[model samples]
Target: MAQVQVQEDPDREERITMEAIVDAYGSEEQAMGWYYYLDDKITFPFQAKCIQARKVSPLKLGEVVEVTAMAPADDCEREMFVLIRWVDRELAVPLVQLEGIDVDDETEEAIADWHYWMARGYELG
Candidate 1:
């Protein structure tokens, strides 16, 4: 774990114009844009810890999971999700719900970027 340099975009106009969503105009397109951006930025098999609890998600606060890959594009037509190795199976958890732990800088920065985006009140789907 190291300090993360997060880039903040606090406005919808800024978010839509981000490199990930510059060509996106609708919700579906923005979702796909974010999906591919994260898929390209994040490195697989990194350890992540649940930072928030969600009723729809099985993960709890402080729970640790090994993140493997991005969930299918269709599945992410709302929010971003990553495939995580859970007990006896794999599950798709919201990317905004987990924080990378002890990962490389690239992976760390990618997650931070998403977190920053959320912290600014941006939403897709």
Candidate 2:
């Protein structure tokens, strides 16, 4: 039998981490969109539908919620609805409603790194 050595790329690892983080919270259009903390109450650029803030898990403040999809609201003008995961109920929320919410430190860091990568012209896959 022959022995083989494997090498790793730190940059690639970082990119993979950033990609997973983005995929967990944001959409393809905005990978870092949901990167903020739940406590920050950050506002989204577009409105979401079916969101019930009261129904969010109180104990999962540090957890990340991904926006799976977005669609135009039927009853509103210039408003959109987004579907999020990790909640018990099917909730959509207006993007503006997310303002000022706090997020976990790891998520924040991942977002920052993702942004940095984007600024460097690294197209996120």
Candidate 3:
């Protein structure tokens, strides 16, 4: 975590910690921890806006989408992804790429926790 950019947030620190990462070891376990952490926290059908663009994702910056669910656990083994509604289809996009809007506090905090991990150069796989 040498590249971590420090910004104080006790809530974020508390929410995204080793404890949430129940038992097991290695990167796979860590991935599963985050998968369930997000799954249990984020409410479905929340609205989000693409805050950043990625080459592998079709989402454009500032595009708004309805986040329906977490992507398959296996698909999120490396980085987290969420299923979002797109033109007549649902697409899985990186969780870090979106910012929640009109979402509950838990969902907002969960996304921020993922962003916090990403900002620190953390990856499960």
Local distance difference test values of all predictions, in order: 0.82, 0.37, 0.87
Candidate 2 wrong stretches, greater than 4 Å = 1-63, 75-78, 98-125
The window of 10 residues in a row where model 3 has the poorest summed lDDT is 15-24
Q: In every candidate, how many clashes are there?
A: 0, 31, 0
lDDT of 1 at 117: 67
- Cα lDDT tens digits, model 1, 5-120, are 45454563364367678788898888888888888878899999999998879999999999999998988887788999999998998998999989888778778777776765
Q: What is the lDDT of residue 16 in candidate 2?
A: 48
Which number leads on lDDT?
3
Over 23-123, each residue of candidate 2 has an lDDT whose tens digit, in order, gives: 45333334333233211232333222222343432323333455544423341122223455535754554433332135444434443443343334434
C-alpha TM-scores of all predictions = 0.84, 0.25, 0.90
Better of 1 and 3 by TM-score: 3
lDDT of 1 at 38: 84
TM-score of 1: 0.84
